[model samples]
Target: MSTTELSLAGSQPGGLGRYNRQAADLHYVTSRVMVYLLAFTAVSVIGFPLFWMVICSFKTSTELYQFPPAFLPHDWTLTNYRDLFIQTNFPIYFVNSLVVAGGATLLSLVVGGLGAYSLSRFKFAGMRTVSMLTLLCYMLPEVLLVIPLYLFVVDLGMADTLISLIIANTAFTLPLTMWFMRSYFNAIPASLEESAMIDGCSRFQAMRKVTLPLALPGLVSVGVFSFNHAWNEFLFALVFTSSETKKVLSLGLATWIGQDNIYSWGMLLAGAVLVTIPVVLFYLLVQRRLVVGLSEGGVKGE
Candidate 1:
């Protein structure tokens, strides 16, 4: 063959090579389409219930009980919300939820922060075992823990109290808070705290002045997670509190549903809407920090 013909033949793609390239491109496009489809499906599944609840909250009682339920209310009204706030013990329940969730979150963060700092920065024996146990505790289901916790609360004479709810929430949340903060602390540079220590600062002062500020994103993420968890917790609240006056929103709203009686479907939906607002608002406020903190934790091998 002439040199030109030989070169041309060498440059031409083999049949297998061309087939492989086409297969890879097809696979790539198919994977992308499947990912987008799954994401859309997940959003619809999770978001539809929330959207429906809000829509029902605005519906009139007649429309709510109509033969075929309407997607959009023909007669929109705030009557449910008005009744929820005015007629029921909803306000008291809301306040109780706030106190318990807030107190639990505060206590979790304080103890978890210090515990995480110790685990990340110190070099004591059984440290690895302690870390593993913290993760195990967090991973365990609340159902498994509630029985013993209920008995403990009764022994302490704290059942049916808001403080008991707070203590219960804190006990469950503190483990996860410790795990998250431990990862975050691992990602932080130790030199920052060391420099503070060299400047006549005690260990606590170094943590307060230097380390804590650096880990603000992680702290915010953990705080929001703890608060949201406590807010949504139902089993602990149900087991701990009995009186209507002491009930949190979760337990209180549950009583609206019964075998023969639904106190008010409209008001039940309204309460659900109200229950979601604080958590959604709190998330929106610190969403950026949550994203950054979690992303950095992964990148840093935590």
Candidate 2:
């Protein structure tokens, strides 16, 4: 008799299960192929407009209005970009946007990181309530708060001030950032914090040396989220800022269109392309860290 162990409890070793296994493997492969195809389709649909806008940016105004649309420029020109620079306050709006968004992001990361560390590491009365309420606060829509926020800023004579915009953006961003960071912190073992504390480190020092380094990805992710929140913000800036010099990109871009006529379509598309580049560039720079942040922040990661 053969001495080798029977495979799959069949009469023969390593050969009894071929027919069923082969069919099942083929089905699994087919399913995976379908999944890949579906994902590719979804990605293509989502990215098409960005590609279309870029193509439109290079087309002449007359070409842009042509029927049946052209994907490639029959006659491309830099006129739109030139007009954007010369005729619009895009430069100041870009600078204001840079300052306001950068400042707000920095402020949110600082406050939120500290709050997250505290909430995750230390226990206190009403802590759970505060955690739950913080998320609820983020859920409070920007539209709902715009009226009160505008009144409050105007009363302080901060209308059109970048500081007002920065503060408002930071306030809107902080609660969510803290919660995101705190969830990440919760996943990190408390023992790590304890070890740092024992090694001549204050709680803050421990965070700086031990926790923060490990949580850099989470930091980057939250930073990206906060940056995007502060950057694209429209309603607050619209209602609060009135001066041409103070306007951010989202509002400033509106001036490209006149009440009576559509502005240069090519130039408008060009402006959009320029506005999109920075955020996309920022994400590309930090995408690796952002992935780590999301994965590490949740309990899903070890």
RMSD to true structure for each model, in Å: 5.4, 4.7
Candidate 2 segments exceeding 4 Å error: 1-44, 255-262, 288-302
What shift in Å separates residue 157 of candidate 1 from its native position after superposition?
1.6
lDDT of 2 by residue, 1-302 (tens): 12322344366345555665677679989999999999999999998998899998988888888999988999878998998899878889999999999999999898888898889888999999998788778778888888898988989989889999999897778886888888888879989978889988998788788888888877778888788888899888888898899999988887666731546777778989999999998888787766765554333366
Q: In lDDT terms, which candidate is top?
A: 1
- lDDT for each candidate structure: 0.86, 0.83
Model 1 pairs in collision: none
Give lDDT tens digits, candidate 1, residues 109-190.
9899899999999999999999889877876888988999999999999988999889888877798788889988988989
State model 2's lDDT.
Answer: 0.83
Candidates in order, TM-scores: namely 0.82, 0.82
The true-versus-predicted C-alpha distance at residue 136 of model 2, in Å, is: 0.9
10 residues in a row with least lDDT, candidate 1: 293-302
